[model samples]
Target: MKMEPIEINEITGYWTFLRNIDWRDPWLIGLIFFHIFTTTTALLTRNRINFQVILFLTLLSMAYFSEPINEYAALNWKIFSKQQYFDSNGLFISTVFSMPILLNCMLLIGAWLYNSTQMMAQLKSAQMKQRSRKEAGIATEAKKTQ
Candidate 1:
């Protein structure tokens, strides 16, 4: 029997769509929440390299312990068996190393870029204020001498 993949559009919205979800698996739900939390945290944080590293590690760990990956393996056991590829643990281990590393790098780069822009804007504003103050002082001095 052939199986149809779940359409992304089907689950694209609010919590009301929970009624349509067939498998109420806790692991799957937890993993989804974990990913959301880590990704959101990574994005919202400002200038915290250590926090980014921690979040990246959390995301990577989530991939290894992901219920979705296990479910997929179970559903396609035949395909997995046909190949000489390692078992579910192998899948988890491989993901633990790769996906998290990439995610961490991206988060770090984004944070760096964002912090740089903010600093540059502040510096420009300060400079402008100082220039204006100096000009006002010069104008007042000229008027006093006139």
Candidate 2:
């Protein structure tokens, strides 16, 4: 039997290609949960460098490795034969995977900066309460002195 060179669309149907937008795809949506799970794991284990490193590495490896494997299987098996996806074509999915991890890292570093905005409000309320307490304590102090 002779072989045929695969044109991109031969691998994926054009109609299948047009069907879903980024967030609507099943895998991309599944990735949202993956991101949240991985992000939560990364956040909860702050004391151990090894755990954080391992989790981050796991996320990286999944992005770099698991995604390609998934795509290959889908294409080869004709699971997604209706749509063609190259690693490059999947820029959207790749972005989706990266967003949560990137945001988690940034949130840790930026949360304190954000907290500063509220710091003055918190301190002023606390100070006002303390001032009222001190003003009201004059009678109690006189009784103690007596």
Candidate 3:
């Protein structure tokens, strides 16, 4: 028995549909909110809006969608193995399981990149200020000697 793969759109739609429902697993909802907030922070602080972040956002959203996927799989997916039936998590772990892990890792990497960019920008500004001060000092000395 083969488990049907959940479509990314379906996952998104699932979240949308459930958004109105107050009843939800707190653990899953908390995870979703945390990822969303952190990813958004990364996007705002990111130095360059390149294709890489775009791809990362795509995957991040995909990760957001997986909560529904897990729910659907638990309720709907039926795979037969001997006398016992294992769920979707039993097989194709990489495609399904790895998605959320990748999402979390990407969020962390994005945060790091954003913070590094901010630090470098600050360093550059400081160097400019120091150079201006040195130039002013030299000019003042030249006038004093004259």
Candidate 4:
């Protein structure tokens, strides 16, 4: 007796879709590498100017490529409004696309906070040093007068 093929329903189909993704695709690999490089630079760079430049470039690139990336994802995942087979594709695509953006924004905010705190600490130290110098000068003048 001949056996029939199993029909892929919503539950089983998603795993199949994920498994079928072409890991060897050059565009996908490039995108992965780019994100990695940018994320590491954002995390490790000590120079504020450099960090700002990298952040600007990253945002620019994302804006320039957003439409193409969305189209590519939709094509690969067969995401469509009419199809009920993979309703989760919208969530999946949004998550995949937004994660890097969210990460970079968080990093930028963290860097800003760190810089502000450092500046405040430096200002406090300078003020303390100036106050000490003024007190020492006043004491020396009083000794001279006596």
Report the number of the highest-TM-score candidate: 4
Q: Of models 2 and 4, which has the larger TM-score?
A: 4
Candidate 1: tens digits of C-alpha lDDT, residues 58-111: 666655555565556656756633322223455432443345545655776777
Per-residue error for 36 in candidate 3, Å, reads: 9.7
Please report the TM-score between candidate 1 and the true structure.
Answer: 0.46
lDDT of each: 0.58, 0.58, 0.55, 0.61
Superposed model 4: Cα runs more than 4 Å off:
1-24, 50-89
How much lDDT does candidate 1 score?
0.58
Residue-level lDDT for 30 in candidate 4: 71
Tell me the lDDT of model 4 at 42: 76
Give the higher-lDDT candidate: 2 or 4. 4
Specify the highest-lDDT model's number.
4
For residue 65, give model 3's deviation from the true position in Å: 23
TM-score of 3: 0.42
Worst 10 residues of 1 by lDDT: 80-89
Stretches > 4 Å off in candidate 2: 1-24, 70-89, 98-146
For candidate 1, give the lDDT of residue 20: 39
Alpha-carbon error at 133 in model 1, in Å?
1.2
Worst 10 residues of 2 by lDDT: 1-10
